[model samples]
Target chain A: MATLSLRDVRKSFAATQVLHGIELEVADGELVVIVGASGCGKSTLLRIVAGLETATSGQVVINNRDVTELEPADRDIAMVFQNYALYPHMSVFGNMAYGLKIRGMDKAEIERRVKAAAEILGIGPLLERKPKQLSGGQRQRVAMGRAIVREPALFLFDEPLSNLDAKLRVQMRAEIRRLQRRLGVTSLFVTHDQVEAMTLGDRLVVMNAGRAAQVAPPMEIFERPADTYVAGFIGSPAMNFIPAVLEDGGASAKLEDGSSIRFADGPRPGPAGRRLTLGLRPEHVEPTNGDGSIPLTVELIEPLGSETVVHGRAAGGMPIVTRLQGAFSGQSLSVHLSPKHLHVFDAETGRRLDS
Target chain B: MSSTALPAAVPMQAERDDALLRATRRRRVMSKIVAHGALILGVLIVAFPIWMTLVGSTHDAATIGRGDVPLLPGSHAIENYATAWNEGGGKSRTTPAALMLWNSLLMALLIAVGKITISILSAYAVVFFRFPLRMAAFWAIFITLMLPVEVRIIPTFQVIVDLSLGNTWAGLIIPLIASATATLLFRQFFLTIPDEFVEAAKIDGAGPLRFLKDVVLPLSLTNIAAMFVILFIYGWNQYLWPLLIINDRSMETIVVGLSKMIGSGDSQNEWNTIMATAVLALLPPVLVVALMQRWFVRGLTETEK
Candidate 1:
C-alpha cells in the first residue's frame, strides 16, 4: 500500500520562506493536486515530496517510511518534469529503460517494463525514435512512460501538461487521471492551471502565498472557498468580491450601494453590523427582467460562441462579469445574485465567515 | 488615347530598368573577379611555406646544403624519403624517422585522451554537484587558462625529475595532459544542459555515476569529439615541452627530432631530411582535424546553443 504524508513541511531559500508549514496526506491511489499561482510554492512542495528538494523542517513519509533525509533515488518515487526531460540522445525505449537499467534490473525485465509502459502510453511504434524526433505531445507521453516504467511508490508530476497547448492539455490530463486510477499509485501533481486541478485532483490544495488556503474536493472549493483568495482564484473570470456589512443578525450582508443579499443556507458566525466581503461567481449571477435585481451598467460583452460574458459595473462601482445564454445587448441590464451563491469573508483578514 | 500614352511611358521606364539591371550585372561580374583574385592571393601567401617545404623535401641533401633550394621537386624524392624514414640524418644521431613518428603518435593520443577524460570528469563535478568552495575550485581551474606550459617549464621539469618520470612516455604525456581550456569548455557546455535532466535522473533512481554515463556523457558526444580534435592537434604540436622533458633519443618526438636534424647555424644541416620530417610531423594533426571537421564545427555551434 502506497501512501504519502507531509508533516509541517517548510522550505526557506536564504531569507525568504517559500513554503510555510505545509501539511498534506495522500491515501493509497489518491491523486492530490496542489494548485496555485506562480511562486506560491506548489512546485516546491512537490519537489520536497520527490526528494529533489529538502524541507528546512519536517518529515516526508512514504509508505510508512521516513524519507525526508533520503536521496530521491532511495525514496522510490518517479517524477515527470514540466519540460518532459527525456534524454535527447536516447530512443523512447532507452529513456524509459534507463531508470531500470540503473537499478541493475534484468535485461528482459527492463525490456518488458519499457514495452508495457510504451504500450500504455500508446507510443509503442515510436519507441525506436529519439526524443528530438517526437512531437511535443509524444515527448510528453514518453516522459510519462519513463516515470511509469519505474513503477515507483509515488508519482510526482510538476506541471507536466503546462508546456502543451490547451487542447492537448485537456486530453492528456484525462489520460493521466485514467492511468493513475488504473495503476492505483498515490500521486501528487502541481500546476498553476485551475482547470487541471479541478478536473484531475481527487482533492485540491488551493495554495496562496506559500500556504494552502483551502483543501477540499473541486466542487467544494468552487462552492465554498475558505477565504477571499480561494474565492477569487478558483473560478473562470474569477468570483466577484464587493465590500459589504453584515446586518440582520448576520443573516444578510448589505452592499456598499445599499443592496442587500442574505445567506441562503444559514446565518454566518458573525454579529450584525460587522464588515465583510461578499463574493459571487460570474456563472452564478442570473439575469432577470424585473426591478427586484441590482442594476448593472453594461460596459462590454464577450461572445464565446454558445454563451456571452457581459462585463459591467454593479451599483456599488465594483466591476463584475455574468455569463448569459445566447446573447444580450443593452447599455444597462439587471442581474440577480441568489443568496445561496453568496460567499462572505472577513473584510480585514479575508477569511471566510459563513459556513 | 490613354493606351497610346501608357505604351510610350512603359518603353521609357523599361529602357531605364534595363540599363540599371545591366549596370548591376556588370558590377557583380567585376566584383566576383576581384574576390577570386584576392582569395587566390591569400591562399598562395598562406600556402607558400608548405609548398616550399614540399619541394625542398624532394631534393638531395647536398643540393639543399649548396643553398640552392628548388621551387620544383627534384629527382631524389624516393631516396630522401627512404633515407629519412630508415635513418636519422644528423651526423651524430641515427634514430629512425619511423620510431619518432610512433613516439609522437603515442604521446599525442595519450595527451588528447587524458586531457579529455580529466576535463569531462572535472567539468561534470563542477557543474552538477554543489559542494563547499565550488566557485573557488572552478576559479582555481579557470585561472590556469592563462598559464601555458611554456610559462611553467622549469618547475614542471623539476617536478618531472622529482617524480622520476624523466625520459619516460609518462613524463612526456602527463606534464601536458591537464588542460584548463578543455575543462572550461566542457564546463560551459555542461552548464547549457537543462537542470531538468539531472532532476529527472535523480527521480529515476540513477546515481551520480550512472547519470554521467547514461545521460551526461551521451549528450556530450559531439562536444567530446570536437574537443578530441582540438586537443589532438594541441598535443601533436607540442615542441618545447617534449624537448625539455625527453633526454633519451628514443623518446624524442618527431617535432623535437626534426629540430635536432637541423643543426645550429652554419653547420651542414640535413635540410632535405629535416623538411621530410616536418611533412611527417604535420600529417597526423592535419588528418585528425580534416577527419573530425564536421563534428568539430557542429559540436562548437551546438555547445553554444
Candidate 2:
C-alpha cells in the first residue's frame, strides 16, 4: 500500500462540471469516507481515484507516479458498488475467483484466495449458488469477496450497502469496516449517509455542490462544521435554521410573536444588526417552562426506541426539531436552547461565523 | 322495524327477492356467453390457415384440386415426403429440400452467434468504460436499428459482391454482424446492473476482457437465449437478400428454394408437395421458438428496463 494524491483534480461531462478542483490525499492504509447529499460529486471523486473517470485538468498521483490516464484495471484498486454487480451467470466461487484468474494467478491459488475470502464473508455454503439465487446481502458479500481476492493497493466502496435492508445494512456495514481494518489497505468510500460516514470513515470529507466543505474526523465534523452546508449536511434531523440579527452584547433572533431569544458567544466578526442565521441541533433542545424562550408548538412526534423526535415550528416561522429522551407523552410542548450549542451563519453568504 | 330490517317470509318478499337474484344471474350468464363467443372467434381466425396448411400438406395433387380432403391425416403423406426429399433430381440442377433447410439453419447459427458475441463486447465497452468517442459510437450503432436494411441494401449488396461472398454463408453473416437491437438491449440491461458490481470486479483486478467473459457474459445467458430465438427466426425467414444474390439453385435457402419450386417447373405446381416442403421447412425455426419461448418475452421485457 502507498499514498495516493490528487492535485487540483477537476472533472466535467461536456459543459456540466461535476467535480471542481478536488485536492485530497490518502496515506498508506488510510480509510477516507466522502459524504454529501445527492449530486455533491463525492461519488465522482472516488471514481476519479479508482481511474474509472479521468480528471479534466489535474493530476492523480499514486506512490509519486502520475497515473491520471490509467484504466481501472491498471490502477490496482478494488471497488465495491452499491448494487453489487455480481456476474449473474457465475456461481459465488466463479465470481470471487474471476479477478485472480484474469491477472494470471494459478488455478489452485485462485481457489485458495476465493475460499479464504468466502470464508471471511461466511459465505462458504454459497460457493456453488448463482447470483440470482443469492439474496441482496449475499450478492453484496460476493462483490466484496471478488474484491478481497485481489488484495489490490486500494479498496473503493461506492455506497455498497444502499440496496440492503436496514438490519442487513448495519450488519454488512460493520462487516465491511472490520474487513477493511483487518486488511488495512488505502481506501476511499463514498456515501450520502452521514451516519455511515461517521461510523465507517477514518476521516470524513464533507462535500457540497462539487466542493469539499470540510475534511475532518467524525467527532470534529459534528463539533466544528467548517461552513453552514457542512453543518446541515453532516447531522441527523438536520440543524434548524432561524433568521437572526446581531445586536448589543449577543446574537438576537426576533420571534414571530415579536419577542426575541438571545444567545451569547465570543465577539461577532460582522457588525451589529447584520442579518444572520441561527442553527440549533435537535439533541441540544430542552423543554422549557416559559414563553421567553424559543417558543415552539409541537406538530409531529416520532418515537424510535431510545428517543422521541418532536417536530415543531419555532417563532418567526422557522421549522424546529427537539429530541426528547425516551418516549415523552406530551403534544403541547416548548423548547429552550442551551445557549452555547447554537451555530451562527451569515444569512446572505451562508458561511459559519464560529469555529 | 328499522330501515335495514327484513320482513318475515311473505308473498311480497319471496317473489321480489327471487326476481332480483334472477336478474343478476342473467347478467352474469350473458357476460359468460359473450366472453366465450369472443374466444371462439379469435381461435377460429388464427387456427383456420394452420388447419388448412396441415390438411393440404397431407393430400396429393388430386385431392387438393378436388378440394375434398378431410380433417384426418392422409395416407399420401409418405409419398409427399419422398417427393420433397428427392425433388425428382436425376440431374442435380437444383438442391433438394433438406439441403436448403441445412443452409438456412447454418446461416441462422452463424448470424445468431456472431451478433450476440459482438453485441456483448460492444455493449460492455460502451456501458462500463470511459474512452474517447464512447457515447458517439453507441449512438452510431443505435442509429442503424432505426434505418432499415432496405435503405442500405444496394451498398450492402455491392460490398458483398466485391468481397466475392455472393451466394455464400459469409455473405449472409458479414453485413448484419453488429445487430443494433441486441447491442441496445444488452446496453440497457448492463446499465441497470449496479455500478457497484463493476467496481467489485475491477477491485478484483479483472481486466475488461475478463470482466466481459467472466462477469458480464454469464449474467447474460437469458439475453443470449432470447437473442438466439429472435435472430434465428429473422435469419431463417429472410428471403429477399438470399433470393437476390443466389442465382445458383443449389445455394438457395429454404424460403427461396421453396418459392422456386412453385413457378419454375411444369409439374402442375405440385400444390401438395410445395405445402409439405413449406411445413417441413418451418418446423426447425418453430421448434427453436418453442424451446426459447418463455425466455424470449422475459428477455425482451427485462432488458428494456
Candidate 3:
C-alpha cells in the first residue's frame, strides 16, 4: 500500500494543452477513481501515474518516492488494460507468472503465487488453458490474477471492465472491489463510467476537460457538487439549470418567466439583482397540486419499473426533467422545485454559491 | 375453421419441402462427382513427369539409352540406386551422389534458417523501433525485391570472388539469404500484433529482446514454418548461381551436379544413375512441405493475433 501524490500535474501536446495543472492526493489503500467523459484526459492521468506517459510538467510521488523518471516496470505498479491484454499464446498460469519470472523469481515461488492468485479468482482449473479458450469473464479474471501475483505497490486499471457485457461488467466491478479491499493495494482506476466510479471508488475524482472538477465521496459529489458540471454529470437524468436572478437581498431567485422561489436554507451571500443559475435535480422536483407551482408542458414520458421520468419544458422554453414516484398519464403537470435541495450557482462562472 | 384448413395445407407443404430437399441432395452429389473428377485429373497431370522419372530410375541404363524408357519397374532398380549412391554419374565420376545430396540439403537448410532469422529481426526493427531513417531503411529493403539474383548476378559474383568466397558454401548461401520478400511478409505480420501486448510486456519488466523471445517469437511460429518451406524449396532448386560459384566438384549441389550428369548424344552415359540422382534431389523439399503443410495453410489464412 502506498500514497500517490500528483503535484501540479500538467500535460500538453504540441500547442494544445490537455491537462491543466491537476493536483490530487490518494491515501494508501484508497481506490480513487478518475471518472469523466471521453477526451477528458482521465485515461491520460492514469497512464501518467502508470508511467506509460510522462507528464509535460509535474511530480508523481508514490509512497514518498519520486517516480516520474522511472519506467513502468521499475515503478513497481501493475495495470489491467481494457482489453485484458492477456498473452494469447501463453496459458493462464504462464500469463500470471511472467512478471515474476522476468524478475528472476524462483520457479517454485512463481508457481505458488500464481496458484494462490488463481485460487482467489476461482480459476484454478483453468491454469493450463490458453486465453483464446477462456470466456471473456474468465480472461478478465486471469488479467486480474496477473496483476495480483505481482503484488505491486500500486494498481492501475484503465477501464478494465469496459470490454465485458453489461451483466459481467457489474459482476466484475463488484469482484474487483472485493479483491482490492482484500489485497489493500493503493489503486488508481480510470473510466468514463460515472456509475462504475460511484459504485467502485472509495473516493471519486470527477474530471472535466482534463481537470479534477470535484474530488469527494460519491454521495458528497451527488448531494453537493462543486460546480454545475459535476452537478449535472453525477446524477441520473442530470440536474436542471434554470436561468434566474437573485431577488430580495439574495433571499429568493426570480426565474426568467417571472416566477420567484424563496430559498429555504437561508439567504445566499450574493448581491441583489445578481444573475444566478438555480440547480434542481430531477428527483428533487416534486409533482404538486399546491400554489407556487410551475407548469411544465410534458413532451415525453419514460415509464421505468419503479419511477417515471417526465421530460417537459417550463415557461420561457427552459427544458426540465422530473422523476416522479409513479406512473402519471398527463399532458402537463406542475412541479415544485424544493428550496431545500436547490443548487445555487453564479450564472457567469458555473461555480456553486453557498448560502 | 383455421385448424381444419391447416391440416390440408400441412401435407402439401411437406411434399414441396421434400422435393426441394431431394433436388438439393442431387445437386450436391453431382457437384461432388465433378469436383473429385477435376482434382484427380489435375493431380495426374502434375504427377506424370515425376512418375516417369521414378519408373525410369528403376530401369537398366541400356533401356533408357536406347529410348525405350520402361513404364514399369525393372529388376535393375537395386543396382542402379547403389551405383548412383556410390559412384558419381558424370564422365569424370568425381562427385558422388551421396556428397551432392548432402551438400544440397545443408545449403537449403542454411539458406532457409539464415533468411528467416535475418528477415524476422530486420522486420522487427523496422516495425517496432523509432530510429532515424527507419522508413528509408524499409523502402531500401523493399526495393531489393525487384532485383532478382539474375539482375545483379555479375556484380554479386565479382563480390564473391573478391571476398575469396568462391567455391565455398558462403558464396552459395550468403548472397541469397537477404530476402526482401520474407522481410516484408514478417513486417506485415508483426504490425497486426496489438500495442497492448507490448505495453504489457513492458510492464512485466521485459526488455526488447525478452519481449521478442517470449511473445513475438511464439506468435510468429506459423509464419516462420511457412517461410521455411518456401525458402527451402527455393534453395534446393538453385541451379544458375550454384553453377557459377562452385568450381570444385565436391562443392557442387545436387541441382548443379544433376545437370552435369547428362551428356549430349553420348551412348555410354549412365542414364539410370542420373535418374536416380534426380529422384533423390526432389525428396527433401517434398518432405519439408509434407511435414509443415498444416502450419503453412494456417500461416497464410489465419492470424494468431
Top lDDT prediction, candidate number: 3
DockQ of candidate model 1: 0.60
What lDDT tens digits, residue by residue, belong to model 1 across residues B1-305? Answer: 99889999998999999999999999999999999999999999999999999998899889888888689999887877888888877776557789999998998899999999999999999999999999999999999989877899999999999999988988888879888999999999899999998998887787889889888888888888988988888888789999888889988888888888877776678888878878877888888988899766776565422
lDDT tens digits, residues A78-118, model 3?
A: 99999989998899999999999999999999999999999
Best by DockQ: 3
| Winner by TM-score | 1
Clashes of each: 0, 4, 0
lDDT (tens digit, per residue) of candidate 2 on A33-95: 999999989888988888877779999888787888887788777778777777666678987
Model 2 lDDT tens row, B148-205:
8878889999999999998777787777677999999999878977665676666556
Candidate 3 residue-wise lDDT at B192: 93
Quality of model 3 by C-alpha lDDT: 0.92
Per-residue lDDT tens digits of candidate 3, residues B149-244? 899999999999999999999888999999999999999999999988998998999999999999999999998998999999999999899999
Candidate lDDT (C-alpha), each? 0.88, 0.80, 0.92
Which is better, 2 or 3, measured by DockQ?
A: 3
Per-residue error for A265 in candidate 3, Å, reads: 3.2
Scored against the true structure, residue A256 in model 1 reaches a CA lDDT of 79
Model 3: TM-score, first chain? 0.98
DockQ of 2: 0.41
